[model samples]
Target: MEQDVSLGLAIFVEHGREREAADFYGSAFGARQFQAHHIDGALAGVEMRLGATVIAVAGANPRREAEPSRGGPFFPKVAGGVSTIIQLTVPDIDGCFAQAIAAGATLRDEVQTDVAGRRVASLFDPFGHIWVLIERDASAGRRAA
Candidate 1:
Protein backbone atom coordinates (compact mmCIF):
# COMPACT_ATOMS: atom_id res chain seq x y z
CA MET A 1 0.00 0.00 0.00
CA GLU A 2 1.17 3.48 -0.84
CA GLN A 3 1.28 6.11 1.85
CA ASP A 4 -0.63 9.31 1.26
CA VAL A 5 1.45 12.40 0.84
CA SER A 6 1.02 14.82 3.71
CA LEU A 7 3.92 16.90 4.89
CA GLY A 8 7.11 16.63 2.83
CA LEU A 9 10.29 18.65 2.50
CA ALA A 10 11.75 19.94 -0.76
CA ILE A 11 15.40 20.81 -0.35
CA PHE A 12 17.18 22.78 -3.05
CA VAL A 13 20.79 21.75 -2.89
CA GLU A 14 23.71 23.89 -3.98
CA HIS A 15 24.64 23.89 -7.61
CA GLY A 16 26.07 20.55 -8.78
CA ARG A 17 25.77 18.90 -5.35
CA GLU A 18 22.47 17.17 -5.79
CA ARG A 19 23.97 13.69 -5.96
CA GLU A 20 26.26 14.33 -3.03
CA ALA A 21 23.36 15.40 -0.82
CA ALA A 22 21.39 12.31 -1.81
CA ASP A 23 24.33 10.06 -1.05
CA PHE A 24 24.93 11.68 2.31
CA TYR A 25 21.32 11.21 3.34
CA GLY A 26 21.42 7.56 2.31
CA SER A 27 24.56 6.74 4.27
CA ALA A 28 23.97 8.89 7.34
CA PHE A 29 20.23 8.53 7.75
CA GLY A 30 19.49 5.23 6.01
CA ALA A 31 17.39 6.99 3.42
CA ARG A 32 16.30 5.08 0.33
CA GLN A 33 15.97 6.65 -3.09
CA PHE A 34 12.74 5.62 -4.71
CA GLN A 35 12.70 7.89 -7.74
CA ALA A 36 14.98 10.09 -9.79
CA HIS A 37 13.91 12.93 -12.02
CA HIS A 38 15.95 13.89 -15.01
CA ILE A 39 16.02 16.57 -17.65
CA ASP A 40 17.66 15.92 -21.04
CA GLY A 41 19.68 13.05 -19.57
CA ALA A 42 21.01 15.15 -16.71
CA LEU A 43 19.92 14.53 -13.14
CA ALA A 44 17.33 17.05 -12.08
CA GLY A 45 15.91 15.80 -8.79
CA VAL A 46 15.51 12.85 -6.49
CA GLU A 47 12.84 11.51 -4.19
CA MET A 48 13.98 9.64 -1.12
CA ARG A 49 12.43 8.11 1.96
CA LEU A 50 13.80 8.40 5.46
CA GLY A 51 11.58 6.02 7.34
CA ALA A 52 8.02 7.06 6.44
CA THR A 53 8.94 10.64 5.61
CA VAL A 54 9.66 11.67 2.03
CA ILE A 55 12.09 14.34 0.90
CA ALA A 56 12.69 15.84 -2.49
CA VAL A 57 16.21 16.90 -3.37
CA ALA A 58 17.04 19.12 -6.31
CA GLY A 59 19.62 21.53 -7.62
CA ALA A 60 19.41 25.29 -7.18
CA ASN A 61 16.82 26.86 -9.41
CA PRO A 62 18.66 29.31 -11.61
CA ARG A 63 15.36 30.63 -12.84
CA ARG A 64 14.50 31.89 -9.39
CA GLU A 65 17.61 34.07 -9.32
CA ALA A 66 16.81 35.54 -12.71
CA GLU A 67 13.31 36.18 -11.56
CA PRO A 68 13.79 37.41 -8.01
CA SER A 69 10.28 38.78 -7.64
CA ARG A 70 8.87 35.40 -8.64
CA GLY A 71 10.22 33.96 -5.42
CA GLY A 72 9.58 30.40 -4.46
CA PRO A 73 12.69 28.42 -3.42
CA PHE A 74 16.39 28.46 -4.16
CA PHE A 75 19.61 26.89 -2.96
CA PRO A 76 20.98 28.34 0.24
CA LYS A 77 23.55 31.02 -0.54
CA VAL A 78 25.07 31.02 2.92
CA ALA A 79 25.92 28.40 5.47
CA GLY A 80 24.26 28.63 8.89
CA GLY A 81 21.61 30.74 7.20
CA VAL A 82 19.37 28.04 5.82
CA SER A 83 15.80 28.52 6.97
CA THR A 84 14.96 24.90 7.57
CA ILE A 85 16.64 22.36 9.82
CA ILE A 86 15.93 18.68 9.55
CA GLN A 87 15.37 16.91 12.85
CA LEU A 88 15.60 13.14 13.09
CA THR A 89 14.66 11.18 16.19
CA VAL A 90 16.90 8.19 16.11
CA PRO A 91 17.33 5.08 18.22
CA ASP A 92 21.10 5.55 18.34
CA ILE A 93 22.45 9.08 18.33
CA ASP A 94 26.12 8.17 18.68
CA GLY A 95 26.04 5.71 15.85
CA CYS A 96 24.13 8.06 13.58
CA PHE A 97 26.42 10.95 14.45
CA ALA A 98 29.44 8.86 13.58
CA GLN A 99 27.87 7.83 10.30
CA ALA A 100 27.08 11.42 9.42
CA ILE A 101 30.61 12.59 10.13
CA ALA A 102 32.05 9.70 8.17
CA ALA A 103 29.77 10.65 5.31
CA GLY A 104 31.14 14.23 5.16
CA ALA A 105 28.87 16.10 7.54
CA THR A 106 30.52 19.01 9.38
CA LEU A 107 29.87 19.04 13.11
CA ARG A 108 27.97 22.06 14.28
CA ASP A 109 27.52 20.83 17.85
CA GLU A 110 28.53 17.74 19.76
CA VAL A 111 25.96 15.43 21.23
CA GLN A 112 24.71 16.62 24.59
CA THR A 113 21.67 16.20 26.73
CA ASP A 114 19.22 19.04 26.34
CA VAL A 115 17.22 20.57 29.20
CA ALA A 116 14.28 18.43 28.15
CA GLY A 117 16.37 15.30 28.73
CA ARG A 118 16.96 14.43 25.08
CA ARG A 119 20.40 13.80 23.65
CA VAL A 120 20.83 16.03 20.63
CA ALA A 121 23.50 17.10 18.17
CA SER A 122 23.65 19.22 15.04
CA LEU A 123 25.63 18.90 11.84
CA PHE A 124 25.81 20.41 8.39
CA ASP A 125 25.85 18.27 5.32
CA PRO A 126 28.26 19.12 2.51
CA PHE A 127 25.40 20.81 0.73
CA GLY A 128 24.72 23.21 3.62
CA HIS A 129 21.59 21.79 5.23
CA ILE A 130 21.52 21.54 9.00
CA TRP A 131 20.44 18.25 10.49
CA VAL A 132 19.64 17.76 14.15
CA LEU A 133 20.04 14.22 15.42
CA ILE A 134 18.10 13.40 18.56
CA GLU A 135 17.73 10.45 20.89
CA ARG A 136 15.37 10.29 23.82
CA ASP A 137 17.21 9.95 27.12
CA ALA A 138 16.36 6.49 28.38
CA SER A 139 17.56 7.25 31.87
CA ALA A 140 14.84 9.84 32.27
CA GLY A 141 12.17 7.19 31.82
CA ARG A 142 13.95 4.87 34.23
CA ARG A 143 14.11 7.62 36.83
CA ALA A 144 10.39 8.23 36.51
CA ALA A 145 9.67 4.53 36.96
Candidate 2:
Protein backbone atom coordinates (compact mmCIF):
# COMPACT_ATOMS: atom_id res chain seq x y z
CA MET A 1 0.00 0.00 0.00
CA GLU A 2 1.35 3.38 -0.98
CA GLN A 3 0.15 6.74 0.19
CA ASP A 4 -0.95 9.32 -2.36
CA VAL A 5 0.73 12.16 -0.54
CA SER A 6 3.90 12.28 1.50
CA LEU A 7 5.84 15.03 3.16
CA GLY A 8 9.58 15.53 2.98
CA LEU A 9 12.19 18.16 3.72
CA ALA A 10 15.18 19.04 1.60
CA ILE A 11 17.87 21.60 2.33
CA PHE A 12 19.72 23.25 -0.53
CA VAL A 13 23.07 24.89 -0.12
CA GLU A 14 25.85 25.92 -2.51
CA HIS A 15 25.91 23.88 -5.72
CA GLY A 16 29.31 22.29 -5.37
CA ARG A 17 28.96 21.85 -1.65
CA GLU A 18 25.90 19.59 -1.66
CA ARG A 19 27.90 16.40 -1.69
CA GLU A 20 30.20 17.77 0.98
CA ALA A 21 27.29 18.56 3.29
CA ALA A 22 25.79 15.12 2.70
CA ASP A 23 29.12 13.53 3.53
CA PHE A 24 29.33 15.49 6.76
CA TYR A 25 25.86 14.36 7.79
CA GLY A 26 26.63 10.75 6.98
CA SER A 27 29.77 10.81 9.09
CA ALA A 28 28.17 12.70 11.94
CA PHE A 29 24.99 10.67 12.23
CA GLY A 30 26.27 7.29 11.04
CA ALA A 31 23.71 7.37 8.24
CA ARG A 32 23.78 5.62 4.92
CA GLN A 33 23.93 7.87 1.85
CA PHE A 34 21.96 7.16 -1.28
CA GLN A 35 22.27 9.34 -4.33
CA ALA A 36 18.98 10.98 -5.23
CA HIS A 37 20.07 13.52 -7.81
CA HIS A 38 23.23 14.91 -9.40
CA ILE A 39 24.17 17.86 -11.53
CA ASP A 40 27.36 19.08 -13.14
CA GLY A 41 29.42 16.11 -11.94
CA ALA A 42 28.36 16.66 -8.35
CA LEU A 43 25.58 15.59 -6.03
CA ALA A 44 22.67 18.02 -6.16
CA GLY A 45 20.46 16.00 -3.85
CA VAL A 46 21.12 13.08 -1.53
CA GLU A 47 19.16 10.98 0.92
CA MET A 48 20.59 10.08 4.31
CA ARG A 49 18.94 7.68 6.73
CA LEU A 50 19.54 8.18 10.42
CA GLY A 51 17.74 5.30 12.07
CA ALA A 52 14.25 5.62 10.58
CA THR A 53 14.31 9.30 9.56
CA VAL A 54 15.42 10.51 6.17
CA ILE A 55 17.33 13.77 5.74
CA ALA A 56 17.93 15.38 2.38
CA VAL A 57 20.69 17.67 1.10
CA ALA A 58 20.84 19.42 -2.23
CA GLY A 59 22.59 22.26 -4.01
CA ALA A 60 20.68 25.51 -3.85
CA ASN A 61 21.58 26.67 -7.35
CA PRO A 62 24.64 26.46 -9.58
CA ARG A 63 25.59 28.80 -12.37
CA ARG A 64 28.29 27.63 -14.69
CA GLU A 65 30.59 30.33 -16.03
CA ALA A 66 30.12 29.00 -19.54
CA GLU A 67 26.39 28.22 -19.44
CA PRO A 68 24.35 31.44 -19.79
CA SER A 69 24.50 33.05 -16.35
CA ARG A 70 21.45 33.38 -14.10
CA GLY A 71 22.12 36.10 -11.60
CA GLY A 72 25.12 35.47 -9.27
CA PRO A 73 25.04 31.76 -8.55
CA PHE A 74 22.47 30.20 -6.17
CA PHE A 75 18.99 31.50 -5.72
CA PRO A 76 16.87 33.30 -3.10
CA LYS A 77 20.09 34.98 -1.90
CA VAL A 78 19.77 33.87 1.70
CA ALA A 79 21.07 36.18 4.38
CA GLY A 80 24.01 35.44 6.65
CA GLY A 81 21.72 34.04 9.32
CA VAL A 82 19.90 30.72 9.13
CA SER A 83 16.14 30.50 9.63
CA THR A 84 15.40 26.78 9.59
CA ILE A 85 16.79 23.96 11.67
CA ILE A 86 17.09 20.18 11.50
CA GLN A 87 16.21 18.48 14.73
CA LEU A 88 17.82 15.17 15.71
CA THR A 89 17.70 12.64 18.49
CA VAL A 90 20.78 10.62 19.31
CA PRO A 91 21.89 8.22 22.01
CA ASP A 92 24.90 10.28 22.97
CA ILE A 93 24.25 13.98 22.70
CA ASP A 94 27.63 15.12 24.03
CA GLY A 95 29.61 12.90 21.74
CA CYS A 96 27.53 13.88 18.74
CA PHE A 97 27.81 17.55 19.63
CA ALA A 98 31.58 17.30 19.94
CA GLN A 99 31.85 15.48 16.64
CA ALA A 100 29.73 18.12 14.92
CA ILE A 101 31.97 20.86 16.37
CA ALA A 102 35.08 19.08 15.22
CA ALA A 103 33.49 18.81 11.78
CA GLY A 104 33.01 22.62 11.56
CA ALA A 105 29.79 23.37 13.49
CA THR A 106 29.58 26.37 15.80
CA LEU A 107 28.02 25.98 19.22
CA ARG A 108 24.88 28.05 19.37
CA ASP A 109 24.21 27.44 23.06
CA GLU A 110 25.46 25.41 25.95
CA VAL A 111 23.90 21.97 26.43
CA GLN A 112 21.05 22.46 28.84
CA THR A 113 19.06 19.93 30.84
CA ASP A 114 16.09 20.77 32.98
CA VAL A 115 15.48 19.04 36.31
CA ALA A 116 12.81 17.01 34.58
CA GLY A 117 15.50 15.12 32.59
CA ARG A 118 15.54 16.81 29.23
CA ARG A 119 18.91 17.37 27.60
CA VAL A 120 19.25 19.30 24.38
CA ALA A 121 21.63 21.43 22.36
CA SER A 122 21.61 23.85 19.45
CA LEU A 123 24.39 24.41 16.95
CA PHE A 124 25.01 26.15 13.67
CA ASP A 125 26.68 24.12 10.97
CA PRO A 126 29.43 25.65 8.89
CA PHE A 127 27.54 24.69 5.75
CA GLY A 128 24.80 27.29 6.20
CA HIS A 129 22.49 25.16 8.37
CA ILE A 130 21.33 24.87 11.93
CA TRP A 131 20.59 21.84 14.11
CA VAL A 132 19.06 20.97 17.43
CA LEU A 133 20.29 17.72 18.97
CA ILE A 134 18.54 15.99 21.82
CA GLU A 135 19.39 12.93 23.87
CA ARG A 136 16.81 10.36 24.86
CA ASP A 137 16.85 8.98 28.34
CA ALA A 138 16.64 5.23 28.29
CA SER A 139 14.91 5.08 31.63
CA ALA A 140 12.30 7.73 31.00
CA GLY A 141 9.66 7.57 28.29
CA ARG A 142 9.65 11.31 27.68
CA ARG A 143 11.46 14.42 28.87
CA ALA A 144 10.02 17.78 29.75
CA ALA A 145 10.40 20.43 27.10
Candidate 3:
Protein backbone atom coordinates (compact mmCIF):
# COMPACT_ATOMS: atom_id res chain seq x y z
CA MET A 1 0.00 0.00 0.00
CA GLU A 2 2.89 2.34 0.72
CA GLN A 3 4.33 1.74 -2.73
CA ASP A 4 0.96 2.30 -4.37
CA VAL A 5 0.61 5.74 -2.86
CA SER A 6 2.64 8.64 -4.16
CA LEU A 7 3.94 11.05 -1.60
CA GLY A 8 2.47 14.52 -1.46
CA LEU A 9 3.52 17.17 1.03
CA ALA A 10 1.87 17.79 4.37
CA ILE A 11 2.96 19.40 7.63
CA PHE A 12 2.79 18.04 11.14
CA VAL A 13 2.66 20.39 14.10
CA GLU A 14 2.84 19.76 17.84
CA HIS A 15 0.73 22.21 19.76
CA GLY A 16 0.32 22.57 23.47
CA ARG A 17 -3.14 23.74 22.56
CA GLU A 18 -4.12 21.67 19.56
CA ARG A 19 -7.60 23.08 19.12
CA GLU A 20 -6.36 26.63 19.35
CA ALA A 21 -3.72 25.93 16.75
CA ALA A 22 -6.33 24.34 14.54
CA ASP A 23 -8.60 27.36 14.83
CA PHE A 24 -5.75 29.73 14.09
CA TYR A 25 -4.79 27.82 10.98
CA GLY A 26 -8.39 27.53 9.90
CA SER A 27 -8.84 31.28 10.17
CA ALA A 28 -5.50 32.21 8.66
CA PHE A 29 -5.80 30.36 5.38
CA GLY A 30 -9.50 29.65 5.23
CA ALA A 31 -8.62 26.04 5.89
CA ARG A 32 -11.44 23.57 6.33
CA GLN A 33 -11.28 20.74 8.80
CA PHE A 34 -11.37 17.44 7.02
CA GLN A 35 -10.82 14.98 9.81
CA ALA A 36 -10.29 14.96 13.55
CA HIS A 37 -9.85 12.41 16.28
CA HIS A 38 -9.73 12.81 20.03
CA ILE A 39 -8.32 10.35 22.50
CA ASP A 40 -7.96 10.60 26.25
CA GLY A 41 -9.24 14.19 26.23
CA ALA A 42 -6.50 15.18 23.81
CA LEU A 43 -6.40 15.61 20.07
CA ALA A 44 -5.00 12.57 18.39
CA GLY A 45 -4.98 14.00 14.86
CA VAL A 46 -6.61 16.52 12.55
CA GLU A 47 -6.43 17.05 8.83
CA MET A 48 -7.14 20.43 7.34
CA ARG A 49 -7.36 21.52 3.76
CA LEU A 50 -5.64 24.78 2.92
CA GLY A 51 -6.40 25.62 -0.65
CA ALA A 52 -5.42 22.45 -2.48
CA THR A 53 -3.02 21.17 0.16
CA VAL A 54 -3.55 19.11 3.26
CA ILE A 55 -1.95 19.71 6.64
CA ALA A 56 -2.06 17.35 9.58
CA VAL A 57 -1.64 18.28 13.22
CA ALA A 58 -1.67 16.27 16.39
CA GLY A 59 -0.53 16.10 19.95
CA ALA A 60 3.18 15.43 20.19
CA ASN A 61 4.06 11.81 20.27
CA PRO A 62 6.57 10.90 22.96
CA ARG A 63 7.74 7.84 21.10
CA ARG A 64 8.65 9.67 17.85
CA GLU A 65 10.73 12.36 19.53
CA ALA A 66 14.02 10.66 18.76
CA GLU A 67 13.93 11.04 14.97
CA PRO A 68 16.73 12.89 13.18
CA SER A 69 16.18 16.47 12.02
CA ARG A 70 15.08 17.59 8.58
CA GLY A 71 14.50 20.93 6.80
CA GLY A 72 17.11 23.44 5.58
CA PRO A 73 20.24 23.81 7.68
CA PHE A 74 20.16 27.61 7.59
CA PHE A 75 17.08 27.69 9.76
CA PRO A 76 18.20 25.69 12.77
CA LYS A 77 14.80 26.01 14.40
CA VAL A 78 13.29 24.36 11.36
CA ALA A 79 15.37 21.29 11.89
CA GLY A 80 13.30 18.96 14.04
CA GLY A 81 10.93 21.84 14.63
CA VAL A 82 7.29 21.41 15.53
CA SER A 83 6.28 24.22 13.21
CA THR A 84 6.55 23.46 9.54
CA ILE A 85 6.41 26.10 6.87
CA ILE A 86 3.80 26.16 4.16
CA GLN A 87 4.25 28.50 1.21
CA LEU A 88 1.46 30.27 -0.56
CA THR A 89 1.41 31.80 -4.02
CA VAL A 90 -0.64 34.90 -4.28
CA PRO A 91 -1.51 37.47 -6.92
CA ASP A 92 -0.87 40.49 -4.72
CA ILE A 93 2.12 40.50 -2.46
CA ASP A 94 1.21 43.59 -0.46
CA GLY A 95 -2.37 42.53 0.12
CA CYS A 96 -1.45 39.03 1.21
CA PHE A 97 1.26 40.41 3.45
CA ALA A 98 -1.20 42.72 5.12
CA GLN A 99 -3.73 39.95 5.64
CA ALA A 100 -1.18 37.64 7.16
CA ILE A 101 0.10 40.38 9.43
CA ALA A 102 -3.40 41.17 10.54
CA ALA A 103 -4.01 37.52 11.25
CA GLY A 104 -1.22 37.50 13.91
CA ALA A 105 1.80 36.49 11.88
CA THR A 106 4.98 38.32 12.70
CA LEU A 107 6.84 39.83 9.81
CA ARG A 108 10.19 38.14 9.48
CA ASP A 109 11.50 39.99 6.43
CA GLU A 110 10.58 42.76 4.08
CA VAL A 111 9.75 41.85 0.55
CA GLN A 112 12.82 41.01 -1.49
CA THR A 113 13.65 40.09 -5.04
CA ASP A 114 15.09 36.72 -5.88
CA VAL A 115 17.25 35.99 -8.92
CA ALA A 116 14.32 34.21 -10.44
CA GLY A 117 12.14 37.31 -10.64
CA ARG A 118 9.81 36.63 -7.76
CA ARG A 119 8.81 38.91 -4.93
CA VAL A 120 9.03 37.01 -1.70
CA ALA A 121 8.45 37.63 1.99
CA SER A 122 8.82 35.42 5.03
CA LEU A 123 6.66 35.40 8.11
CA PHE A 124 6.34 33.52 11.38
CA ASP A 125 2.81 32.54 12.32
CA PRO A 126 1.32 32.86 15.79
CA PHE A 127 2.23 29.22 16.39
CA GLY A 128 5.85 29.86 15.33
CA HIS A 129 5.51 28.16 11.97
CA ILE A 130 7.31 29.82 9.08
CA TRP A 131 5.53 30.73 5.85
CA VAL A 132 6.94 32.18 2.70
CA LEU A 133 4.63 34.28 0.55
CA ILE A 134 5.50 34.57 -3.10
CA GLU A 135 4.32 36.77 -5.93
CA ARG A 136 5.47 35.39 -9.21
CA ASP A 137 5.72 37.27 -12.45
CA ALA A 138 3.17 35.89 -14.85
CA SER A 139 5.83 35.75 -17.48
CA ALA A 140 8.24 33.70 -15.44
CA GLY A 141 5.95 30.73 -14.77
CA ARG A 142 6.23 28.82 -11.50
CA ARG A 143 9.67 27.84 -10.25
CA ALA A 144 10.48 27.94 -6.59
CA ALA A 145 9.16 30.23 -3.86
Best candidate per lDDT, number? 1
Best of the candidates, TM-score? 1
Candidate lDDT (C-alpha), each:
0.86, 0.71, 0.68
Q: What lDDT tens digits, residue by residue, belong to model 1 across residues 1-145? A: 2655477888888756778889888998899999999888888889999988899988877787678799957776666668889899888999999999998889999999989878899998877789999996677679999
**Cα-based lDDT at residue 79, candidate 3:** 29
Each prediction's RMSD over C-alphas, in Å, is 3.4, 5.1, 6.0
What residue runs in model 1 are displaced by over 4 Å at the alpha carbon? 1-5, 137-145
Q: How would you order the candidates by lDDT, starting with the best?
A: 1, 2, 3
Q: For residues 1-145, could you state the per-residue lDDT of candidate 2 as single tens digits?
A: 3666555667667767777777787766676786577665656789877777677777765444235354433322332255567888888899999988887777887689956677998887767567888897866655543
lDDT per residue, candidate 3, 16-69, as tens digits? 556766787776666788888888877866788777677776655544544445
* 1 versus 3: better TM-score goes to: 1
Every model's TM-score? 0.87, 0.73, 0.68
| Candidate 3: stretches off by over 4 Å | 1-10, 62-85, 139-145
